[model samples]
Target: MKDTVVEVKSLDQEWARLILEAKKIGLTKEEIRAFLVSTKEL
Candidate 1:
């Protein structure tokens, strides 16, 4: 397999802040991901 390099940029500051706030209120990353996925249908 060929080697591949991927570079990821940091999350937007607003998103980072929201994530921190969510964590402060006890939301897990998995739960956040699930909530985001569920919103796709709307």
Candidate 2:
């Protein structure tokens, strides 16, 4: 819903293997997708 949200701290991405930097880290493909799930207000 419009009220759904993704906290900045919970989201991290690493594209080093596919692009710029050589150092590798951060969330995997599946982990990154967790941010897209629907959520209800607490």
Candidate 3:
């Protein structure tokens, strides 16, 4: 799988959407952070 990098100037609406989605699925902050770091490693 290829990785896509997204650059955002601020954590506003886009970040809120992502956080909301994660929360809706019951993902903890640590889980989200670990998932992000793991994806970076890939």
Estimate, for each residue in 1-42, the C-alpha lDDT of model 2 and write its tens digit: 478786654444433233223224565665444533422222
Predicted structure 1, TM vs. truth: 0.54
lDDT of 2 at 12: 41
> Which portions of model 1 miss their true places by more than 4 Å?
1-11, 39-42
TM-score of each: 0.54, 0.25, 0.51
Per-residue error for 20 in candidate 2, Å, reads 11
Best by TM-score: 1
Q: Give Cα-based local distance difference scores for all models.
A: 0.77, 0.42, 0.80
Cα lDDT of model 1 by residue, 1-42, tens digit: 998765444445666777789889999999988876886789
Top-lDDT structure, candidate number:
3
Residue 5 in model 1: lDDT: 64
Q: Rank the candidates by lDDT, best first.
A: 3, 1, 2
Worst 10 residues of 1 by lDDT: 5-14
Q: Report RMSD (Å) for each prediction in the order shown.
A: 7.6, 9.8, 5.7
* Model 2 per-residue lDDT at 28: 61
Give the Cα-based TM-score of candidate 2 against the true structure.
Answer: 0.25
